[model samples]
Target: MKLIYVFFFFCIINQTYGQQKELELIHNCQGRLSGFATVKVIDKRDSSGKQMIGIVQKGALNKPVKVVFNGELTDSLAAFFIDQSANSNPLPLVLILNELFISEAIDNMTEIGRFRLSLRLFIGKQSDQYSEIVAIDSLYTVKGLDVTKKLLRSISEQFCKISQLAAEKQPILDTDAEKYTFKQLHYLDSLEKMKLPMYQTDHPSVGLYKNYKEFKQNTPGVTAELSIEERKNGFRVYIWDEKRKNKTKLPSTGLYAVSDGTTLLRATPLGFFKILKKGGDFYYWRPQVNKSHHSLVPAAYMYGALGGLVYGLIEAASAGNNKWLLQKINYRKGSAAPVSWTTAKEN
Candidate 1:
């Protein structure tokens, strides 16, 4: 009985000390970052160029430090920004806001346990924005004036790290289109060789069609056998009329192919292409690089030149005229040449 009593006493002391530590962390952060605690809306623009209104708890000088909205409203807005499925329950915007504080506190080396405990005390019981702020104010007892400078210094350091990481990952050029064209050609070739029936809604088909009805009616087997052959510039796609026993040229679309040394990006003709080396998988389109605009110009120009030359050679080679190929080539200009298919097949 005496041992049990001592254990209970120690447990209570530890709990009390933990509560005190949590309070200290909250006090430190709230005091320092109170000035920077303005509410910000993510992706607030609408089609009419109006800023979507949010529920605001006004601070001094017409600023807002706390914002409240129906949980459904916050979820809907969050879904729009993150492309996540809409949430049915109300989510506390303060929880999201407090993450910014938590991130700052962590950078300052405020013990992780104490920082998390403070956030729990501040917002855990509340499910909406106004209630959360009120809860935090009541639990932490933070006076607006008692400022903590160290927390703000930590936040500035964290922001700098984020900026540096973004800069390091920036691309050198826009090569997505060229890369995408190659993949599409590869996909078309694979489908033909495997004798896989192209589905009506397949990415390549939908990309090539201008109208929905035309896209719907043109079955794969009925139309030409589409195949792609690779060359130095880009790729040459052949549309063969099986009924006519002949091949014809399809309109060529310009593509952009960008590489980060590890990943290849292609955007053009049909859409975006993304090829990651890890899975050995290929895609047709990818998002364009937007952050490092000025640094990419020279590399983009070089890729464009290389892509054009490759595309031209592939087009000529696919046209299947040895005489035409010879006429175009300076070395073979004076030499009589046999048919392209005979030479190509022999080699």
Candidate 2:
């Protein structure tokens, strides 16, 4: 009875003192970068010299370009930048802003109204998020650059600040199933329906295996078959091992990513692929490079002529043609490696 009382007392003391509980680890997230995607609206001058608005629902920039926001309100604007961030490597976050708007504030600069140059930023990363309306720079004391230049500078500066925050905070990310959210719901709906334009490959269908035995009959190591099934309207990936007699199915989205070492294009190039080397996030594969003749400029004009030629060829041989095999994607950059096919076939 005495021992029981002593144990109960100890338990009560522990609870009261807030001791013995395991400490929760707070991961510091770092890295901040900002890229600009053009907004889908058009601005034009009317016959009367007044500004007009046009809408291009399916328009976008060739690629996401880096943007910098300058002036007094840079930090406030950048607070909304979003990008690909992982907890393990948090110092270099690059948030690609899909839509940027710089409004005309001349209409309300009176005593009762302050027409400060305000801005709005929107991003699409499987979710939608935007920054609140903040008055960064007052038009009354504007500087050398115009509204467009100021907006870009401010946006970029905001990103640098976020990078610093990531370096200091190191916020950890949850798994795909964890459903971590940083985006606002209003833009999320628009982002979900947005899809980039892509190219169709010559070889659309690439497989026909009913089961593991059917696909694993004669492959060497880990055999993966990627195919586009037109009838089912889905892309499929199958993986199997010869010795273990086991198979695993990886998720697929009915399309293959092709690249040009500078961009990621989509196409189903029907050819055998190998598991060359695996990296932390990307499966490196040989991309096809086409050395097409752009107007023959002097060697000196194109990277010092002979030196430039050698450099281009070498680049094509290395990262230029290397493509990333991702879990999912719609529109990829042109920075893909060259395209090529090998003879490592599957059963």
Candidate 3:
């Protein structure tokens, strides 16, 4: 019994030692945020399905620990900005944190951290929102022996930098923000709805859609000879170069979706998805499975419907004010249907 007890004790110690540690984000702002008196942050990351703000390596085993905000991310962010905007002045700001993800990897014994943060800055409070002044969707990478610490420091710096950029937006700040009445807001909303291009289902335009706006407009930016090439992992869009008499792989950075008049494939953060069905205010899509590619990356990366900025725009356009509410694009795994879109949350 004593032997068993000792073994159990040792096991407990090992488990405790190996357990991943969580780090709280500490904001170290060098300067104050000018022009904004108060700050409010709206947490919109629930839709992305990625709750972990960052991951850090801890202990001798270098176990990957999930880094989280001490309290709510929104609260932390708001506090960070409010602390920076201590003596701030005229406008109240609303920061809608769309996505915040940090990933860590060890390359050649050097720790590397990658951060992708997406946020939109509104001129007023959440309920009494004035107008979106700035949108920042950016990716940052840092490499060091203590990459996690460096990454955190970088994030803190970014908080200050973002605030400075917001301060420099003189066009909006100089105008009468209070004069932005509901009638003007309605007019703007109506104008956006009018900008939503009609999707002609009968004869949908064929080719590469640079953005959702292009797709809605039914005018593909790239009408070149393009095809979906099956890759070792999944599928990629390739455009045939008539001059070269060869096909060039189209980079997925700016491309939104590609249609062949018969099938519509939407681009998510992960890969392209074959849109299976379109229903009321929602479009269903599943990952394009390659039978030959047995080893596929986990579907977690492909969870979000659209990328950062695009998703934000889509959400705004799909609100009740807009005539088009085709908000969600579902993506599901294993099932006959497409995988669910991470951004398919109800408003």
Candidate 4:
């Protein structure tokens, strides 16, 4: 019994050590592209159809390798190429590329037999040049042309769906045109200066203004105002007439009002108003407004739907490849083999 207990304890220690080592390896492995090569796509369906070519880069990450496509195509097709470039915001093309390459690497590493690779190809009907994703095996042989073609077709269909949805939910100006009016009284009790109108009652709510005097001095066409008031309930705050004519009313109640100069209003559930002013005229504005149609939830959903469709198209395209080509290459499933090389070439 003593010997058996000792053996079990040793096994547990070894298992824990192995798990820790695996976790460290995965955490430290930075995905880096080591090499890249170009491959041409042959059109078996349409012998005279325009040919597609793309470059595939090898990387350490067990994901689909980067495949860049560029060629003559229509405006819409051309836009996809532009979208692939890095931008201020997240680009759908970049996301798609990342998903395709990452998923491919994962699938390859797992040795999953029933995995699919899709690559969406954007093409213009009038252009001779087209973009595509090229899948190469360990031997650097092309094995994913047919799958890419099918994926492109699916992506085109999904794009049409998203376009239709956008047309239906086109933002309307009147949707945000509701106006609010608030009034308050201010009494001046100072003995120093005789009050012309002993007490002036201006809606404390109206006192709300954006302070942008410094901004106006530094940046042309930039102004801000702030209207503050002491009311019976508490302090009333309003930030009015910023660059975009945005108005925010903060009262003692939990509810807050936010509006653009002319239209577009929002109410928040939070009672506290915190404003962070940055730069000359640019300020980060957060307001509590009514839960209305233009709320963040609806906008997020719209973007998510469109994003999902794009992702789906790219995933579908990654799966396309000519069966003839795959067979000729004798493509076999296996994880990306570890590559080791020194950086002496760079020196």
- The candidate that achieves the highest lDDT relative to the unseen native structure: 3
Q: What does the lDDT come to for candidate 1?
A: 0.25
| lDDT value, residue 5 of candidate 2 | 39
List model 1 lDDT by residue over 1-347, tens digit each.
Answer: 44553454344334432121111111122212111122222221121111111111111111112112223432332221221234311222222211222111111212111111111111111222122122111111111221233332333343333223322332213433122222232233233324322121233331233322232232222233554554544445545675848866554444223222222233345432342221111223112111111212332354454433433443344343211110000010111111111112210
Model 3 residue 111 lDDT score:
70
Assess candidate 4 and give its TM-score to the true structure: 0.18
Top-scoring candidate (TM-score): 3
Backbone clashes counted, model 1: 29
Q: Sorted on TM-score, highest at the top, how do the candidates line up? A: 3, 1, 2, 4
Clash tally, candidates in order:
29, 51, 9, 44
For 88-107, candidate 4 gives per-residue lDDT tens digits of 11211110111111112112
TM of each candidate vs. truth: 0.20, 0.20, 0.54, 0.18
Error of model 2, residue 5, in angstroms = 99
Error of 3 at 27 (Å): 3.7
Which portions of model 1 show Cα errors greater than 4 Å?
Answer: 1-222, 253-282, 285-347
